[model samples]
Target: MIETKDKKWSMFGHILMIILSILSLAPFVLLLVSSFTDEATALKNGYSFFPEKLSLEAYRYIAEQWELIGNGYLVSIIVTVVGTLAGVMISAMLAYTLSKHDLPGRSVLMLLLTFTLLFNGGLTSTYIVYTQIFNIKDTIFGLLLPNLLMNAYFVVMLKNYFEHTIPSALLESARIDGATEFQLFYRISIPLSVPMLVTVGMTVALNYWNDWMNGMYYLSANSNIQSIQTILNNINENIRFLQQNNVGTAMTTADLPSATVRMAVAFVGILPMLVFFPVFQKWFVKGATAGAVKE
Candidate 1:
Protein backbone atom coordinates (compact mmCIF):
# COMPACT_ATOMS: atom_id res chain seq x y z
CA MET A 1 0.00 0.00 0.00
CA ILE A 2 2.83 2.44 0.87
CA GLU A 3 4.64 1.57 -2.38
CA THR A 4 1.47 2.24 -4.38
CA LYS A 5 0.97 5.61 -2.62
CA ASP A 6 4.59 6.60 -3.30
CA LYS A 7 4.26 5.72 -6.99
CA LYS A 8 1.07 7.77 -7.26
CA TRP A 9 2.74 10.80 -5.66
CA SER A 10 5.77 10.48 -7.92
CA MET A 11 3.55 10.34 -11.02
CA PHE A 12 1.64 13.41 -9.80
CA GLY A 13 4.89 15.30 -9.21
CA HIS A 14 6.12 14.53 -12.72
CA ILE A 15 2.85 15.75 -14.23
CA LEU A 16 3.01 18.93 -12.17
CA MET A 17 6.57 19.68 -13.25
CA ILE A 18 5.61 19.21 -16.91
CA ILE A 19 2.76 21.70 -16.51
CA LEU A 20 5.06 24.24 -14.84
CA SER A 21 7.71 23.84 -17.53
CA ILE A 22 5.14 24.50 -20.26
CA LEU A 23 3.85 27.57 -18.42
CA SER A 24 7.41 28.93 -18.15
CA LEU A 25 8.24 28.25 -21.79
CA ALA A 26 4.94 29.47 -23.27
CA PRO A 27 5.85 33.17 -23.30
CA PHE A 28 9.22 32.57 -24.94
CA VAL A 29 7.56 30.42 -27.61
CA LEU A 30 4.99 33.16 -28.27
CA LEU A 31 7.75 35.77 -28.47
CA LEU A 32 9.69 33.71 -31.00
CA VAL A 33 6.57 33.13 -33.07
CA SER A 34 5.59 36.78 -32.96
CA SER A 35 9.01 37.95 -34.11
CA PHE A 36 8.50 36.13 -37.40
CA THR A 37 4.90 37.33 -37.69
CA ASP A 38 3.73 39.79 -40.28
CA GLU A 39 3.84 43.29 -38.79
CA ALA A 40 0.36 44.30 -39.97
CA THR A 41 -1.15 40.94 -38.99
CA ALA A 42 0.46 41.05 -35.53
CA LEU A 43 -0.68 44.66 -34.93
CA LYS A 44 -4.19 43.72 -35.99
CA ASN A 45 -4.47 40.24 -34.44
CA GLY A 46 -2.06 40.55 -31.48
CA TYR A 47 0.66 37.98 -30.67
CA SER A 48 -0.31 34.33 -30.86
CA PHE A 49 1.49 31.02 -30.46
CA PHE A 50 0.30 30.20 -33.94
CA PRO A 51 0.24 33.32 -36.05
CA GLU A 52 -1.93 33.55 -39.18
CA LYS A 53 0.92 34.93 -41.22
CA LEU A 54 4.72 34.93 -40.92
CA SER A 55 7.32 37.38 -42.21
CA LEU A 56 11.06 38.01 -42.02
CA GLU A 57 10.84 41.83 -42.13
CA ALA A 58 11.76 42.26 -38.47
CA TYR A 59 14.85 40.10 -38.82
CA ARG A 60 15.77 41.89 -42.06
CA TYR A 61 15.57 45.22 -40.23
CA ILE A 62 17.89 43.86 -37.53
CA ALA A 63 20.30 42.52 -40.14
CA GLU A 64 20.69 46.02 -41.59
CA GLN A 65 22.11 47.11 -38.23
CA TRP A 66 24.41 44.10 -38.01
CA GLU A 67 27.66 46.01 -37.59
CA LEU A 68 26.49 47.80 -34.43
CA ILE A 69 24.86 44.63 -33.12
CA GLY A 70 28.02 42.61 -33.76
CA ASN A 71 30.09 45.13 -31.82
CA GLY A 72 27.52 45.04 -29.02
CA TYR A 73 27.80 41.25 -28.86
CA LEU A 74 31.57 41.46 -28.62
CA VAL A 75 31.43 43.95 -25.77
CA SER A 76 28.75 41.94 -23.97
CA ILE A 77 30.76 38.71 -24.29
CA ILE A 78 33.90 40.34 -22.93
CA VAL A 79 32.01 41.95 -20.01
CA THR A 80 30.11 38.78 -19.10
CA VAL A 81 33.22 36.55 -19.15
CA VAL A 82 35.50 38.96 -17.29
CA GLY A 83 32.86 40.14 -14.83
CA THR A 84 31.65 36.63 -13.95
CA LEU A 85 35.16 35.29 -13.34
CA ALA A 86 36.28 38.32 -11.34
CA GLY A 87 33.06 38.65 -9.35
CA VAL A 88 32.90 34.94 -8.52
CA MET A 89 36.57 34.81 -7.51
CA ILE A 90 36.27 37.88 -5.32
CA SER A 91 33.07 36.68 -3.67
CA ALA A 92 34.40 33.14 -3.13
CA MET A 93 37.66 34.37 -1.62
CA LEU A 94 35.80 36.68 0.75
CA ALA A 95 33.36 33.91 1.66
CA TYR A 96 36.19 31.44 2.37
CA THR A 97 37.95 34.02 4.51
CA LEU A 98 34.81 34.68 6.52
CA SER A 99 34.25 30.92 6.93
CA LYS A 100 37.39 30.77 9.10
CA HIS A 101 36.04 30.91 12.65
CA ASP A 102 39.31 32.09 14.18
CA LEU A 103 39.90 34.99 11.79
CA PRO A 104 40.20 38.40 13.49
CA GLY A 105 37.38 40.91 12.76
CA ARG A 106 35.35 38.19 11.03
CA SER A 107 32.19 39.25 12.80
CA VAL A 108 32.67 42.87 11.79
CA LEU A 109 33.33 41.92 8.17
CA MET A 110 30.31 39.62 8.03
CA LEU A 111 28.15 42.32 9.58
CA LEU A 112 29.30 44.83 6.99
CA LEU A 113 28.64 42.35 4.18
CA THR A 114 25.10 41.71 5.48
CA PHE A 115 24.48 45.44 5.81
CA THR A 116 25.29 45.98 2.14
CA LEU A 117 22.62 43.41 1.19
CA LEU A 118 20.02 45.58 2.92
CA PHE A 119 21.25 48.97 1.72
CA ASN A 120 23.05 50.61 -1.13
CA GLY A 121 24.17 54.06 -2.15
CA GLY A 122 21.40 55.35 -4.41
CA LEU A 123 21.73 55.53 -8.22
CA THR A 124 22.73 59.20 -8.32
CA SER A 125 25.53 58.70 -5.82
CA THR A 126 26.69 55.49 -7.47
CA TYR A 127 26.77 57.27 -10.82
CA ILE A 128 28.76 60.14 -9.37
CA VAL A 129 31.24 57.85 -7.67
CA TYR A 130 31.85 55.72 -10.75
CA THR A 131 31.98 58.63 -13.15
CA GLN A 132 33.69 61.26 -11.02
CA ILE A 133 35.73 59.22 -8.57
CA PHE A 134 36.61 56.16 -10.57
CA ASN A 135 36.36 57.85 -13.99
CA ILE A 136 35.19 54.65 -15.65
CA LYS A 137 33.02 56.67 -18.00
CA ASP A 138 32.69 55.28 -21.54
CA THR A 139 35.14 52.51 -20.69
CA ILE A 140 34.75 48.71 -20.54
CA PHE A 141 35.36 48.98 -16.79
CA GLY A 142 32.10 50.90 -16.55
CA LEU A 143 30.23 47.71 -17.39
CA LEU A 144 32.47 45.50 -15.23
CA LEU A 145 33.17 47.45 -12.03
CA PRO A 146 29.83 48.83 -10.90
CA ASN A 147 26.98 47.18 -8.90
CA LEU A 148 27.13 43.76 -10.61
CA LEU A 149 30.56 42.84 -9.29
CA MET A 150 31.02 41.00 -5.94
CA ASN A 151 27.44 40.54 -4.75
CA ALA A 152 27.01 40.33 -0.98
CA TYR A 153 24.31 37.64 -1.34
CA PHE A 154 26.72 35.38 -3.25
CA VAL A 155 29.35 35.93 -0.57
CA VAL A 156 26.93 34.96 2.21
CA MET A 157 25.76 31.89 0.32
CA LEU A 158 29.32 30.73 -0.33
CA LYS A 159 30.30 31.41 3.27
CA ASN A 160 27.45 29.25 4.50
CA TYR A 161 28.42 26.46 2.08
CA PHE A 162 32.09 26.59 3.07
CA GLU A 163 31.31 26.57 6.79
CA HIS A 164 28.58 23.93 6.94
CA THR A 165 29.00 21.79 3.86
CA ILE A 166 32.78 21.32 3.79
CA PRO A 167 34.20 18.90 6.38
CA SER A 168 36.47 20.69 8.84
CA ALA A 169 38.38 17.48 9.56
CA LEU A 170 39.41 17.32 5.91
CA LEU A 171 40.97 20.76 6.15
CA GLU A 172 42.85 19.78 9.32
CA SER A 173 44.21 16.71 7.52
CA ALA A 174 45.35 18.86 4.60
CA ARG A 175 47.06 21.30 6.99
CA ILE A 176 48.85 18.46 8.81
CA ASP A 177 50.08 17.21 5.44
CA GLY A 178 51.90 20.59 5.09
CA ALA A 179 49.56 22.20 2.56
CA THR A 180 49.80 26.01 2.63
CA GLU A 181 46.71 28.16 3.03
CA PHE A 182 46.71 29.05 -0.67
CA GLN A 183 47.20 25.41 -1.60
CA LEU A 184 44.35 24.35 0.65
CA PHE A 185 42.11 26.95 -0.93
CA TYR A 186 43.05 26.21 -4.55
CA ARG A 187 43.60 22.47 -4.35
CA ILE A 188 40.86 21.46 -1.94
CA SER A 189 38.22 24.06 -1.15
CA ILE A 190 37.80 25.27 -4.74
CA PRO A 191 37.53 21.80 -6.24
CA LEU A 192 34.94 20.79 -3.63
CA SER A 193 32.90 23.97 -4.10
CA VAL A 194 32.56 23.67 -7.88
CA PRO A 195 28.78 23.47 -7.90
CA MET A 196 28.19 26.60 -5.84
CA LEU A 197 30.92 28.46 -7.70
CA VAL A 198 29.40 27.55 -11.09
CA THR A 199 26.00 28.64 -9.83
CA VAL A 200 27.34 32.01 -8.67
CA GLY A 201 29.33 32.48 -11.87
CA MET A 202 26.31 31.73 -14.08
CA THR A 203 24.10 34.15 -12.13
CA VAL A 204 26.76 36.88 -12.36
CA ALA A 205 27.21 36.22 -16.08
CA LEU A 206 23.47 36.61 -16.68
CA ASN A 207 23.42 39.87 -14.78
CA TYR A 208 26.38 41.24 -16.71
CA TRP A 209 24.93 40.13 -20.04
CA ASN A 210 21.48 41.61 -19.40
CA ASP A 211 22.59 44.84 -17.71
CA TRP A 212 22.11 48.14 -19.58
CA MET A 213 21.85 50.55 -16.64
CA ASN A 214 25.61 50.93 -16.33
CA GLY A 215 25.88 51.52 -20.04
CA MET A 216 23.06 54.08 -20.03
CA TYR A 217 24.66 55.96 -17.14
CA TYR A 218 28.35 55.85 -17.99
CA LEU A 219 28.51 55.37 -21.76
CA SER A 220 27.84 57.95 -24.44
CA ALA A 221 25.94 57.38 -27.71
CA ASN A 222 29.24 56.99 -29.54
CA SER A 223 30.89 54.85 -26.85
CA ASN A 224 32.53 51.67 -28.08
CA ILE A 225 31.90 49.83 -24.81
CA GLN A 226 28.13 49.33 -25.31
CA SER A 227 26.71 45.85 -24.66
CA ILE A 228 23.96 44.08 -26.61
CA GLN A 229 21.23 45.12 -24.16
CA THR A 230 22.37 48.76 -24.21
CA ILE A 231 22.54 48.85 -27.99
CA LEU A 232 19.14 47.15 -28.32
CA ASN A 233 17.66 49.71 -25.91
CA ASN A 234 19.12 52.49 -28.00
CA ILE A 235 17.65 50.95 -31.13
CA ASN A 236 14.21 50.72 -29.51
CA GLU A 237 14.47 54.32 -28.36
CA ASN A 238 15.48 55.48 -31.81
CA ILE A 239 12.56 53.57 -33.33
CA ARG A 240 10.20 55.20 -30.85
CA PHE A 241 11.64 58.62 -31.61
CA LEU A 242 11.20 58.06 -35.31
CA GLN A 243 7.63 56.91 -34.77
CA GLN A 244 6.81 59.91 -32.60
CA ASN A 245 8.39 62.51 -34.89
CA ASN A 246 7.71 60.72 -38.20
CA VAL A 247 11.36 61.22 -39.08
CA GLY A 248 12.33 61.85 -42.72
CA THR A 249 13.13 58.56 -44.38
CA ALA A 250 12.29 56.69 -47.56
CA MET A 251 9.91 54.51 -45.57
CA THR A 252 7.04 55.92 -43.52
CA THR A 253 6.61 55.27 -39.77
CA ALA A 254 3.84 52.84 -40.64
CA ASP A 255 6.35 50.71 -42.50
CA LEU A 256 8.59 50.22 -39.46
CA PRO A 257 8.02 46.85 -37.73
CA SER A 258 8.46 48.44 -34.32
CA ALA A 259 6.66 45.82 -32.20
CA THR A 260 8.03 42.80 -34.04
CA VAL A 261 11.50 44.39 -34.07
CA ARG A 262 11.42 44.58 -30.25
CA MET A 263 10.60 40.88 -30.07
CA ALA A 264 13.39 40.04 -32.52
CA VAL A 265 16.00 42.13 -30.74
CA ALA A 266 15.07 40.73 -27.32
CA PHE A 267 15.37 37.15 -28.59
CA VAL A 268 18.71 38.00 -30.16
CA GLY A 269 19.97 39.48 -26.90
CA ILE A 270 18.91 36.47 -24.81
CA LEU A 271 19.87 33.81 -27.36
CA PRO A 272 23.30 33.25 -25.82
CA MET A 273 21.85 32.64 -22.36
CA LEU A 274 19.26 30.26 -23.77
CA VAL A 275 22.04 28.29 -25.44
CA PHE A 276 24.30 28.56 -22.37
CA PHE A 277 21.89 27.59 -19.54
CA PRO A 278 21.09 24.11 -20.82
CA VAL A 279 24.78 23.28 -21.29
CA PHE A 280 25.60 23.88 -17.59
CA GLN A 281 22.16 22.90 -16.30
CA LYS A 282 23.50 20.00 -14.24
CA TRP A 283 25.97 22.11 -12.30
CA PHE A 284 23.39 24.89 -11.95
CA VAL A 285 20.85 22.50 -10.48
CA LYS A 286 23.43 20.99 -8.12
CA GLY A 287 24.55 24.39 -6.87
CA ALA A 288 21.05 25.74 -6.52
CA THR A 289 20.06 22.81 -4.32
CA ALA A 290 23.42 22.44 -2.58
CA GLY A 291 22.36 23.12 0.99
CA ALA A 292 18.80 21.85 0.94
CA VAL A 293 17.81 19.32 3.61
CA LYS A 294 17.36 15.88 2.10
CA GLU A 295 15.21 14.23 4.75
Candidate 2:
Protein backbone atom coordinates (compact mmCIF):
# COMPACT_ATOMS: atom_id res chain seq x y z
CA MET A 1 0.00 0.00 0.00
CA ILE A 2 2.82 2.44 0.87
CA GLU A 3 4.63 1.65 -2.39
CA THR A 4 1.47 2.36 -4.38
CA LYS A 5 0.94 5.70 -2.59
CA ASP A 6 4.52 6.78 -3.18
CA LYS A 7 4.32 5.90 -6.89
CA LYS A 8 1.10 7.86 -7.32
CA TRP A 9 2.60 10.94 -5.68
CA SER A 10 5.74 10.64 -7.81
CA MET A 11 3.67 10.42 -10.99
CA PHE A 12 1.63 13.48 -10.03
CA GLY A 13 4.80 15.43 -9.30
CA HIS A 14 6.25 14.48 -12.68
CA ILE A 15 3.10 15.68 -14.43
CA LEU A 16 3.24 19.04 -12.62
CA MET A 17 6.92 19.43 -13.45
CA ILE A 18 6.23 18.75 -17.13
CA ILE A 19 3.57 21.46 -17.23
CA LEU A 20 5.92 23.98 -15.61
CA SER A 21 8.70 23.10 -17.98
CA ILE A 22 6.51 23.71 -21.01
CA LEU A 23 5.43 27.10 -19.66
CA SER A 24 9.05 28.13 -19.21
CA LEU A 25 9.96 26.94 -22.70
CA ALA A 26 7.04 28.63 -24.46
CA PRO A 27 8.61 32.09 -24.74
CA PHE A 28 11.82 30.72 -26.24
CA VAL A 29 9.74 28.83 -28.83
CA LEU A 30 7.96 32.07 -29.71
CA LEU A 31 11.27 33.92 -30.01
CA LEU A 32 12.65 31.24 -32.33
CA VAL A 33 9.57 31.50 -34.55
CA SER A 34 9.54 35.31 -34.53
CA SER A 35 13.18 35.39 -35.58
CA PHE A 36 12.21 33.76 -38.87
CA THR A 37 9.32 36.19 -39.51
CA ASP A 38 9.87 39.52 -41.23
CA GLU A 39 9.98 42.64 -39.05
CA ALA A 40 6.73 43.98 -40.51
CA THR A 41 4.99 40.64 -40.02
CA ALA A 42 6.25 40.38 -36.44
CA LEU A 43 5.16 43.92 -35.67
CA LYS A 44 1.74 43.26 -37.20
CA ASN A 45 1.26 39.83 -35.60
CA GLY A 46 3.03 40.43 -32.26
CA TYR A 47 5.20 37.29 -32.36
CA SER A 48 3.24 34.13 -32.82
CA PHE A 49 4.36 30.91 -31.14
CA PHE A 50 4.77 29.38 -34.59
CA PRO A 51 6.44 30.80 -37.67
CA GLU A 52 3.98 32.84 -39.72
CA LYS A 53 6.29 32.80 -42.74
CA LEU A 54 9.59 30.93 -42.95
CA SER A 55 12.63 33.03 -43.92
CA LEU A 56 16.42 32.82 -43.63
CA GLU A 57 17.32 36.42 -44.52
CA ALA A 58 18.14 37.26 -40.89
CA TYR A 59 20.59 34.39 -40.63
CA ARG A 60 22.18 35.49 -43.93
CA TYR A 61 22.65 39.03 -42.67
CA ILE A 62 24.32 37.67 -39.55
CA ALA A 63 26.51 35.51 -41.75
CA GLU A 64 27.56 38.62 -43.69
CA GLN A 65 28.78 40.13 -40.40
CA TRP A 66 30.36 36.84 -39.32
CA GLU A 67 33.94 38.05 -39.13
CA LEU A 68 33.37 40.22 -36.07
CA ILE A 69 30.70 37.95 -34.59
CA GLY A 70 32.82 34.85 -35.03
CA ASN A 71 35.78 36.51 -33.34
CA GLY A 72 33.53 37.35 -30.39
CA TYR A 73 32.38 33.73 -30.22
CA LEU A 74 35.98 32.53 -30.14
CA VAL A 75 36.88 34.99 -27.41
CA SER A 76 33.87 33.99 -25.31
CA ILE A 77 34.64 30.30 -25.69
CA ILE A 78 38.25 30.80 -24.60
CA VAL A 79 37.28 32.91 -21.62
CA THR A 80 34.57 30.52 -20.52
CA VAL A 81 36.80 27.45 -20.72
CA VAL A 82 39.86 29.00 -19.07
CA GLY A 83 37.95 30.91 -16.44
CA THR A 84 35.76 28.00 -15.44
CA LEU A 85 38.71 25.66 -15.01
CA ALA A 86 40.79 28.15 -13.03
CA GLY A 87 37.89 29.34 -10.87
CA VAL A 88 36.67 25.85 -10.04
CA MET A 89 40.16 24.69 -9.07
CA ILE A 90 40.81 27.65 -6.84
CA SER A 91 37.37 27.49 -5.25
CA ALA A 92 37.63 23.77 -4.61
CA MET A 93 41.06 24.11 -3.00
CA LEU A 94 39.91 26.84 -0.67
CA ALA A 95 36.75 24.90 0.13
CA TYR A 96 38.71 21.74 0.90
CA THR A 97 41.13 23.55 3.18
CA LEU A 98 38.30 25.26 5.00
CA SER A 99 36.51 21.97 5.41
CA LYS A 100 39.42 20.69 7.47
CA HIS A 101 38.77 21.68 11.08
CA ASP A 102 42.45 21.22 11.89
CA LEU A 103 43.43 24.15 9.70
CA PRO A 104 44.36 27.17 11.81
CA GLY A 105 42.66 30.49 11.15
CA ARG A 106 40.16 28.84 8.82
CA SER A 107 37.21 30.48 10.48
CA VAL A 108 38.75 33.92 10.12
CA LEU A 109 39.49 33.31 6.47
CA MET A 110 35.96 32.09 5.88
CA LEU A 111 34.54 35.15 7.61
CA LEU A 112 36.60 37.47 5.44
CA LEU A 113 35.46 35.64 2.30
CA THR A 114 31.83 35.73 3.42
CA PHE A 115 32.08 39.47 4.11
CA THR A 116 32.43 40.16 0.41
CA LEU A 117 29.16 38.38 -0.24
CA LEU A 118 27.24 40.69 2.10
CA PHE A 119 28.96 43.94 1.13
CA ASN A 120 30.96 45.02 -1.84
CA GLY A 121 32.41 48.31 -2.98
CA GLY A 122 29.94 50.06 -5.25
CA LEU A 123 30.42 49.88 -9.04
CA THR A 124 32.22 53.19 -9.37
CA SER A 125 34.81 52.27 -6.74
CA THR A 126 35.33 48.81 -8.24
CA TYR A 127 35.78 50.39 -11.68
CA ILE A 128 38.28 52.86 -10.29
CA VAL A 129 40.27 50.10 -8.66
CA TYR A 130 40.33 47.93 -11.77
CA THR A 131 41.22 50.76 -14.13
CA GLN A 132 43.48 52.95 -12.04
CA ILE A 133 44.99 50.67 -9.45
CA PHE A 134 45.18 47.43 -11.38
CA ASN A 135 45.49 49.01 -14.88
CA ILE A 136 43.47 46.13 -16.35
CA LYS A 137 40.80 48.13 -18.14
CA ASP A 138 40.18 47.37 -21.83
CA THR A 139 42.29 44.20 -21.49
CA ILE A 140 41.48 40.49 -21.59
CA PHE A 141 42.76 40.20 -18.03
CA GLY A 142 40.25 42.80 -16.90
CA LEU A 143 37.35 40.77 -18.35
CA LEU A 144 38.49 37.46 -16.86
CA LEU A 145 40.19 38.48 -13.62
CA PRO A 146 37.40 40.18 -11.72
CA ASN A 147 34.72 37.53 -12.20
CA LEU A 148 36.80 34.38 -12.70
CA LEU A 149 38.98 34.27 -9.60
CA MET A 150 36.64 33.26 -6.77
CA ASN A 151 33.05 33.28 -5.57
CA ALA A 152 31.92 32.98 -1.96
CA TYR A 153 28.75 31.05 -2.70
CA PHE A 154 30.56 28.44 -4.76
CA VAL A 155 33.14 28.09 -2.01
CA VAL A 156 30.46 27.54 0.61
CA MET A 157 28.76 24.99 -1.59
CA LEU A 158 31.99 23.07 -2.11
CA LYS A 159 32.96 23.26 1.54
CA ASN A 160 29.63 21.86 2.52
CA TYR A 161 30.02 18.98 0.10
CA PHE A 162 33.48 18.16 1.42
CA GLU A 163 32.55 18.39 5.08
CA HIS A 164 29.37 16.35 4.90
CA THR A 165 29.97 13.83 2.15
CA ILE A 166 33.72 13.03 2.31
CA PRO A 167 34.43 10.75 5.27
CA SER A 168 37.17 11.86 7.69
CA ALA A 169 38.39 8.26 7.97
CA LEU A 170 39.37 8.29 4.32
CA LEU A 171 41.65 11.28 4.81
CA GLU A 172 43.09 9.78 7.99
CA SER A 173 43.88 6.51 6.22
CA ALA A 174 45.53 8.36 3.32
CA ARG A 175 47.60 10.42 5.72
CA ILE A 176 48.70 7.24 7.53
CA ASP A 177 49.90 5.85 4.21
CA GLY A 178 52.18 8.92 3.87
CA ALA A 179 49.97 10.69 1.34
CA THR A 180 50.82 14.38 1.34
CA GLU A 181 48.05 16.98 1.54
CA PHE A 182 48.49 17.93 -2.08
CA GLN A 183 48.54 14.31 -3.24
CA LEU A 184 45.45 13.41 -1.24
CA PHE A 185 43.65 16.48 -2.56
CA TYR A 186 44.51 15.74 -6.17
CA ARG A 187 44.10 11.97 -6.10
CA ILE A 188 41.47 11.25 -3.50
CA SER A 189 39.34 14.30 -2.68
CA ILE A 190 38.96 15.41 -6.27
CA PRO A 191 37.84 12.00 -7.47
CA LEU A 192 35.21 11.84 -4.75
CA SER A 193 34.03 15.39 -5.50
CA VAL A 194 33.44 15.06 -9.19
CA PRO A 195 29.79 16.00 -8.94
CA MET A 196 30.47 19.27 -7.12
CA LEU A 197 33.27 20.16 -9.49
CA VAL A 198 31.10 19.61 -12.53
CA THR A 199 28.28 21.65 -11.01
CA VAL A 200 30.56 24.55 -10.07
CA GLY A 201 32.37 24.43 -13.39
CA MET A 202 29.13 24.53 -15.35
CA THR A 203 27.82 27.44 -13.27
CA VAL A 204 31.04 29.40 -13.79
CA ALA A 205 31.10 28.56 -17.49
CA LEU A 206 27.54 29.78 -17.93
CA ASN A 207 28.34 33.01 -16.10
CA TYR A 208 31.33 33.65 -18.35
CA TRP A 209 29.36 32.79 -21.48
CA ASN A 210 26.34 34.99 -20.73
CA ASP A 211 28.21 37.92 -19.22
CA TRP A 212 27.72 41.34 -20.86
CA MET A 213 28.29 43.68 -17.93
CA ASN A 214 31.94 42.68 -17.64
CA GLY A 215 32.45 43.46 -21.32
CA MET A 216 30.63 46.78 -21.01
CA TYR A 217 32.84 47.77 -18.08
CA TYR A 218 36.22 46.54 -19.32
CA LEU A 219 36.13 46.22 -23.11
CA SER A 220 36.21 48.68 -26.01
CA ALA A 221 34.48 47.95 -29.29
CA ASN A 222 37.89 48.30 -30.96
CA SER A 223 39.39 45.66 -28.66
CA ASN A 224 40.29 42.28 -30.11
CA ILE A 225 38.55 40.37 -27.29
CA GLN A 226 34.88 41.23 -27.26
CA SER A 227 32.63 38.50 -25.79
CA ILE A 228 29.86 36.96 -27.87
CA GLN A 229 27.09 38.29 -25.63
CA THR A 230 28.39 41.85 -25.82
CA ILE A 231 28.82 41.67 -29.57
CA LEU A 232 25.31 40.27 -30.09
CA ASN A 233 23.78 42.88 -27.77
CA ASN A 234 25.53 45.65 -29.66
CA ILE A 235 24.27 44.25 -32.95
CA ASN A 236 20.70 43.99 -31.69
CA GLU A 237 20.67 47.49 -30.24
CA ASN A 238 22.18 49.04 -33.34
CA ILE A 239 19.73 47.30 -35.62
CA ARG A 240 16.66 48.12 -33.51
CA PHE A 241 17.54 51.73 -32.70
CA LEU A 242 19.59 52.81 -35.72
CA GLN A 243 16.85 51.89 -38.16
CA GLN A 244 14.42 54.32 -36.53
CA ASN A 245 17.05 57.07 -36.44
CA ASN A 246 17.80 56.53 -40.12
CA VAL A 247 14.15 56.32 -41.16
CA GLY A 248 13.20 57.74 -44.63
CA THR A 249 16.79 57.20 -45.76
CA ALA A 250 18.09 54.85 -48.52
CA MET A 251 18.43 52.12 -45.85
CA THR A 252 14.70 52.16 -44.99
CA THR A 253 13.83 49.32 -47.34
CA ALA A 254 17.29 47.96 -48.01
CA ASP A 255 16.17 44.32 -47.38
CA LEU A 256 17.94 44.12 -44.03
CA PRO A 257 16.21 41.48 -41.92
CA SER A 258 16.94 43.10 -38.53
CA ALA A 259 14.28 41.12 -36.64
CA THR A 260 15.40 37.79 -38.00
CA VAL A 261 19.05 38.58 -37.38
CA ARG A 262 18.33 39.40 -33.73
CA MET A 263 16.76 35.98 -33.34
CA ALA A 264 19.62 34.25 -35.10
CA VAL A 265 22.09 36.12 -32.96
CA ALA A 266 20.29 35.00 -29.81
CA PHE A 267 20.10 31.47 -31.09
CA VAL A 268 23.80 31.37 -31.88
CA GLY A 269 24.78 33.03 -28.61
CA ILE A 270 22.79 30.50 -26.53
CA LEU A 271 23.83 27.42 -28.52
CA PRO A 272 26.89 26.59 -26.41
CA MET A 273 25.05 26.68 -23.09
CA LEU A 274 22.23 24.62 -24.56
CA VAL A 275 24.73 21.98 -25.56
CA PHE A 276 26.46 22.05 -22.17
CA PHE A 277 23.48 22.07 -19.77
CA PRO A 278 22.12 18.60 -20.51
CA VAL A 279 25.59 17.12 -20.40
CA PHE A 280 26.10 18.51 -16.90
CA GLN A 281 22.53 18.29 -15.54
CA LYS A 282 22.86 14.95 -13.71
CA TRP A 283 26.06 15.93 -11.96
CA PHE A 284 24.76 19.41 -11.15
CA VAL A 285 21.64 18.07 -9.45
CA LYS A 286 23.59 15.52 -7.43
CA GLY A 287 26.12 18.11 -6.30
CA ALA A 288 23.42 20.61 -5.42
CA THR A 289 21.62 18.07 -3.22
CA ALA A 290 24.84 16.81 -1.66
CA GLY A 291 25.74 20.33 -0.62
CA ALA A 292 22.25 21.21 0.55
CA VAL A 293 22.08 18.95 3.62
CA LYS A 294 25.26 19.74 5.47
CA GLU A 295 25.82 18.36 8.98
Report lDDT per candidate: 0.89, 0.83
Worst 10 residues of 2 by lDDT: 286-295
Instruction: Measure candidate 1: CA RMSD.
Output: 2.7
Q: Which residue ranges in model 2 land beyond 4 Å of their true spot?
A: 1-4, 253-256, 282-295
Q: Per-residue lDDT for 1-295 in model 2, tens only?
A: 9999999999999999999999998877777787778766766676786646677778877887799988999999899888989999999999999999889998899899899889989899988988899888888877688886548899999999889888888878899999999998898788778888997888888888999888989888678799989999988988877666765565574455676777788888897887778868977677556534244
Best by TM-score: 1
Q: lDDT score, residue 130, model 1?
A: 87
Write the residue-wise lDDT of candidate 1 on 208-272 in tens digits: 99999889988998997799999999999988998899997797899999999999988998999
